[model samples]
Target: MKFLVLCLIALIHQSASQSPQASCQFENSIDYTCVLTLTNPNGLNNITEIEVNHMPNRTNDDVVIVRTSIFSTSRNIPSIICDTFRNLRSIDMFRTGLTKIDEDSVSNCKLLELMTVRFNQIADIHPNAFAENAELRTVQLDANNLTSVPENLFENNKKLVEINLSQNGLAVLPKKLLSGLSELRGLFLTHNQISEIYEDTFADATNITSLGLGNNSLTYLPDKIFSSLYNLLDVYLQNNQLMKFNPYWFQNAKSLRALYLSNNGITYFPEDSFVNFYKLRELMLDRNPIQKLPGKIFASLGELTWLDLENCQLVYLDPSLFLSTYNLWMLKLANNDIYELPGGVFGSLKYLATLDMTNNQLQAISSTSFYFHPDLRTVRFGQNQINAVDEKFLDVVNVTQLNMEQNVCADGFWNDDSETKELFRTELRVCFENYIEPPQYCPIGNEYERICELEAQTASLTLENAGIRRDLEGLAARIEQLERLISSSP
Candidate 1:
C-alpha cells in the first residue's frame, strides 16, 4: 500500500508539468489550462465569452480566456496573446483563414466559451463543433460566406446570450436553430437574402434587445415575428423592397426605441406605421420613393425627434404635418422637386432647430417660410437652382455655410461700395472663429460676411500651393500632413 501511494504521486506530478498551448484574452499575465473534466465540448461552436477591452482581464491563478477579438481583428483573422492562466475562456477565429473546427480539433481547449467566425469564406461547419460548456455568451458570424447552419448548433449552451448571424446567405432560418438557447438577447440578420421570416425565428430568445433585418428582400412581415421577444428595443428594416405597410406589423413591439426604414420602394407610409412603438425616438425614412405620406404619418410616435425625408419623390407635401410631437428638432427635405415652401410648413414644429432643404428647386425664399422663434440654426441651399435668396433665409446662431455658390444671387446684395463690407466681414470672422461644432446662422450673416472676409484676407495669405508639390510621390506623406495643418488652422 505504501509503494502504490508513491507511484500515484509521481503520476500526478508528471501530468501537471506538461503545459498545454493557451490563449490570453485580457492584459493579465495569469496562466490557465484546459479544465477538461468540467467542460463538455458537444455544443456548436462552444464559446466561453472573454470580452477584451469591454471586460477587464480576469487575473485568476487558474487559466482564463481573455475576450479581445473585436479590438484586435476583423473577420477570420487570427492573433496570439501571452497567457499565464491554465484555462482559456474565449477563442476568436473570426475572418481568419479557418475553414472548420469541431470537438476533435479543439479537444485540448477544454474551457472555451465563445468563438468569433465572422466574414470568413467558410462553406461548412460541423454540428458538434462545440459542446456543453455553459460559460459561453456570444457567437458572432456576421459577414461570413456561410451557406447553411447545422442542427442543434447551440444545443446545450445554457449561458449563451447573443447569436449574431447577420449578413449571411440564410434563405430561411431553421425552426430549431435557437430551441435550446433560452437566454439569447440579440438576433442580427441585416443584409441577408432572407425573403421570409417564420414564427420560429423568435422561439428561443426571451430577452432579445435588438433585431436587425435591415437589408432583406421581404415584402411583408408575419404576425409572429416578435411573439417571443418581449424586451426588444430596436428594429431595423431599411433598404427592403416593402411596397405596403400594415399597422399590425409592429403591434407587439411596445418597447421599441428606434425604427429605420429608409432606402426602400415604399410609395406610401400608413398612418399606423408607428402604431405600437411608443418609446420610439428616431425614425428614418430617407431615400424612399414615397410620393406622399399619411396626414398623421408620425401621429403615433410622440417622442419622434428627427424625421429624414431626403431624396424622396415628394412632389407635394402638407404644411401642417407635425401636430403631435412637441419635441421635434430636425426635418430634412433635400433633393426633392419642392417648388415652394408653404407659408405654414413649419407651423407645427415650433422647436425645430435645423432645416436642410438642400438640392431642391425653389424659385425664392420668403421670411414667412420659416416659423422658428429664433430656434433655427443651419439651412442648406446647395445643389439647387435657387434663383434668389434674401435676409429671410437664415438666422444669427453659431456657424452657417449657406452653399449657394452656383445659385443666381442678384448683384449688389451686400453693399454698393466695398467699405461697408468690412463691418460684415468682422462679424462673420469672429463668429466662425469662436463657435464650436459647425453652427447655423442667418444667411445674411453667413454668406455676405464670408464673401467679404475671404475677399479681404485672400490678398494677404501666401503659402506653397499643393499643386506645386505633386512632383514626388515619395514625399507625399510628409507633404500631406503639412497641407492638412495649414488648411485646418485659420
Candidate 2:
C-alpha cells in the first residue's frame, strides 16, 4: 500500500508542527493589523477560539489591531480572549503576568480605541473595567501593581486622551477620579505612593496639560490644589515632602511651564512665590534646604530659563537673586554654603550658560567673578577655597569648561584650555605671587586692592631679579680665577 501511505503522511506533518497555535507569532497587517507575539508562554493558558480560528491567512473578521506580547504569563487575561477580537481597534497587553482586571477583561473589545496593559502584575481593575470600551482613547496602565484605581475608572472613557498610572503603587487619588475626563490631556502619576491629593483631585481634570506628581509622598498640597489648572503646562512636583512653597499652589496655574521642585523639603519661597509664574520656563529647586532666597524671589520669573539651585544650604545670595531671571540659561549654584558671590551677583546673567559653583565656601574668583557672562560656558569651581584667581580672571569670561579642581593652585593650576587662557593668565601671575587680602567678606573689590598691590610690586621685582643672578655668578667665578693667575705668572 505504498509503505502504508508514506507512513500516514509523515504522521500528519508532525502533528501540524506541534500546535498550540504553534506557539503564536503572527503578524498579519495590511490594515487588518494583528501582531501577536507570545514568547515564553510555555504554560500556554488560553487563546483559543481555536486560536483565533487558526490564524494563518487572518480570518476572525480579518483582525483589526490586536498587538499582544504575552511573555511569562502568570494568569488571568484569557477571559473570553477579547471575545474573539470583535473587530478590535487596539489591544496591546505587554509583559503579561497579569493579576487582576475583571469585567470580562476587554468587555468584548467593543470597538476599543486603544488599551495597553503595560508591564503587568496589574493589582485590580474591574470597576466595569472599561464599561464596554466606549471608544477609549488611550489607557496605558503604566508599569503596573497599581495600589488603587476605580473611582469609576474612566467612567465610560469619554474619549479619554491619555492616562498612564506611572510606575504604580498609588497611595490615594480617587477624588471623583477625573470624573468625566473631558478629553484628559496627559496625567502621569509618577512613581506613586502619593501622600495626599484630593482637593477635588484635579477638579474635573480641566484640560490638564502634563501633570506628573514626581516620586511622591507629598508633604502638603491642598491650597486650591492647582486652583483649577487653567490650561496648565508641565508641573512635576519632584521627589516630594514639600515643606513650603504654596503661592496658592499656582493661583490658577497661569499656563505654567515646567516646575519640578527637586527632592523637596523646601525651606522657603513665599515672596509672591512666583507672582503668577509669568509663563515659567523650567525651574527645578534642587535638593532643597534652601538657606536664603527671597530677593523678590525671581521677581516674577521673567520668563525664566532653567534654574536649579543645587544642594541648597546656601549662605547668602540676594544680589537681586537673578534679577528677574534675565532669561537665564542653566544656573546651578552647587553644594552651597556659598562664601560670597554678591557683587552684581551674576550681574543680571547676560544669557549665562552653565555655571555650577561646586562644593562652596569659595574664597576668591573675583574679577566680578564671571563679570556678566557673555554667553559663559561651563564654569565649575571645584571644591572651593579658591586661593584668589583674578588676574582679570581669564580676562572676563569666555570659559569653555574651567573646573578649578580643589583650588589654591598647584594641580597643573587648572585647565580646560581656551589655550588655557594665556596659561591661566601666566598661572595667575605665579599663583598669587603672595596674594592675600581677600576677606572683608570677599566679594573682592578695591580692584582687589589694586591687584594685591601689583602682586606685591611683582613679588619685589622677583626678588631683585634673583639678587642680580647671584651677583653675576659670583663675578663670573672671579674672572675664572684671574685667568688662571695670569697664565701662571708668565
Candidate 3:
C-alpha cells in the first residue's frame, strides 16, 4: 500500500507538469511522451540547469535560471519547452529543431538577453516572440530557414541593438517587424530572398551605420528607403535585379562613403544618378549590361578614388568624362567592348596610381593622354588593336608595363582643355556682404517660398528701375553672391 501511494504521487506530479494546452502549431502532430521528474541536485534551492523533462512540480515565479543548458549535442529548442525555468538569463540551444514559439512563454523568460537558435527547423516563429522580454538585446539566427517574418516581431523590446537573420530563406520582409527596436544599430539580412519593403521599413533606425542587403531579389526601392539611416556609412546592394536607378533613392544617405552595386541588371544609369553622393570613395559596378555611359557620367562623383567598371559593354565615352574625378587612384575598365579611348580621357587624375585597361579595344595613346601625372605606377593597354608605337610614347613619369601588344592607331587624339580650371577659383571668392549658399534644385534644399520672395522683391524694385532681369539689380546681385559662396565652399 505504501508503494502504491508513492506511485500515485508521481502520477499526479507528471500530469500537472505536462498538461499545457497547445496554442502554437507544429510542422507535424506527434503525441508527446515526455514525463518530467526534476530533483535539485544541490538541494531544491541551489540548482541552475535542468533537463526539460525534469521540471519539478512548482508554482513559484522567482526560480532564478542561471544556465538552462541542453544535454544532447543537438541545439534546437522547443518553443514552450522551458516552462520550468522562471528568471532565465541566457539560453543557448542553437542549431536545434525548434518549430513553433509559444508567445506566452516570452513573459516567463523576462530577463533573457542572448538567444542563439540558428540552423534549426524553425520555419515560423511567433510574431510576439519577444513581446515581454524587455532585456533581450541580441538574437542570432544566422543559418535558419525562416520563410516569412511577421509584424510585431519586436514590438516592445525597444533596447535591441544587434539582430543577425542572415543566410535565411526569407521571401518578403514584413512591415513594422522592427517597429519597437528603435535603438538597433547593426542589421544583417544578407544571403536571403527578400524582395519587398515599404518606404518606412528603415524609418526608425536612425543610428544604423552599416546595413547589408546583398544577394536578394529586390527589384525596386522607394525614394525614402534609406531616409532614416541618416548616419549610414557603408551600404551593400549587390546581386539583385535592379532594372533602373533613381537619384532620390539615397536622398538621406549623406554620409555613405562605400557603396557596392555590382552584379545587377542595370543597363545604363542616369549620369546624375550619383550626383548627390558627393563623398563616395569606392564604387563597384562590375558584371552588368551597361551599354551607354553618358559623356558627363562621373561629373559629380568628386570623392571617388577607386572605380571598377569591368564586365560591361562600354564602347563610347566623352574625353571629359573624368573631369570631376580629379582624385582618382585606381581605375579598372577591363573586360568590355571598349572600341576607343581618348588619349587624354584620364587627364584630370592628378593622383592616379594604377590603370588597368586590360582586354579592351585600345588602338593608340598620345603624349597628352596622361600629360600631368607625377605619381602614375602601372598601365595595362593589353589584348587590343596595337600596331604603331611612337618612339616618344611610354615615357610616362612612373609607368611600369608599356603593354602595346594589340593596338592599331597612329596616335590617340587629345581634346585636352588647355585652359587652366583653377583660375576661376579667385574670381568667385570676391567679397560680398550678405553671401549665402545658393539655392539648389532639390525640393528640400530650395523651397518655393524663397523663389516667391525673390520674385516679389524684384518686381517692386524693378518698377522704379528697368525691365531687363539684370536691371533688377539688387535681386540678381544677391543670387550671384549666393552662387559664388556656394561654389567656394568645400
| Per-prediction backbone clash count | 41, 1, 12
Model 1 residue runs over 4 Å out of place are: 1-61, 66-86, 105-111, 388-399, 410-490
Reference-based lDDT, each prediction? 0.57, 0.71, 0.61
Is candidate 2 or 3 superior in TM-score?
A: 3
lDDT of 1 by residue, 12-72 (tens): 9865543222233334344332221111112123233332322344344344544433323
User: How far out, in Å, is residue 75 in model 1?
Assistant: 14
| Residue range 145-264, candidate 3, lDDT tens digits | 788777778877788887888888888877786675678878888899989878888887778777888899999998878877887778888999988777777777877788888999
Q: Which model, 2 or 3, shows the larger lDDT?
A: 2
> Which candidate do you rate higher for lDDT, 1 or 2?
2
Model 3 weakest 10-residue run by lDDT:
23-32
